[model samples]
Target: SVSVLSYAVIFAASTKLDITRKDSIKFICTFAILELVIELLYISYYERKKMISLLKGEK
Candidate 1:
């Protein structure tokens, strides 16, 4: 889950120059969603690695 304040900051920064509500909302939503997906993928990879290590008795 992306932090709310971070999302707001992102939304604010993107629209600070243009002052357009639509553009800012679009940019923020896209970025936040992408970041959330990437974080989930990273977590999945780490969990899988841990499981593999445990199976091999290396941890």
Candidate 2:
């Protein structure tokens, strides 16, 4: 899953930087928020195109 992969990457980076758990969690949360926004945009675009195609097919 992307969530697991993202968390794993964050933890690895944090360890490399010698940061604390708090900082790592903060980065993970920010990344999740950004991912949500991007996912929404992607879904919206995909659905819009699909509906347009279906409408065209009906006509």
Candidate 3:
């Protein structure tokens, strides 16, 4: 829901600011990739202990 609202705000701002399509695509794609990388890092960091235990075949 936050992501959707962010995208909606970006779209609205782009239209109001008269940004070009190519620039908008580039900006949105970059934002999305950055968000995904951050999310993955957050998950990996928090799950590291569980993952290590699983790799050692623990119950």
Worst 10 residues of 2 by lDDT: 2-11
Query: Could you tell me which residue pairs clash in candidate 3?
Result: none
Per-residue lDDT of 23 in model 1: 79
Error of 1 at 57 (Å): 0.9
lDDT of 2 at 3: 84
Which tens-of-lDDT digit does each residue in 1-59 have in candidate 1?
44888887787678668668887888878987898899999999999999999999998
Could you tell me every candidate's TM-score relative to the true structure?
A: 0.77, 0.77, 0.73
Runs in model 1 lying further than 4 Å from the true structure: none
Ranking by lDDT: 3, 2, 1
**Position 50, candidate 3: lDDT:** 83
Model 2 CA lDDT for position 51: 94
Question: How do the candidates rank by TM-score, highest first?
Answer: 1, 2, 3
- RMSD, every candidate, angstroms: 2.2, 2.2, 3.1
Tell me the spans in candidate 3 whose CA falls farther than 4 Å from its real position.
49-59
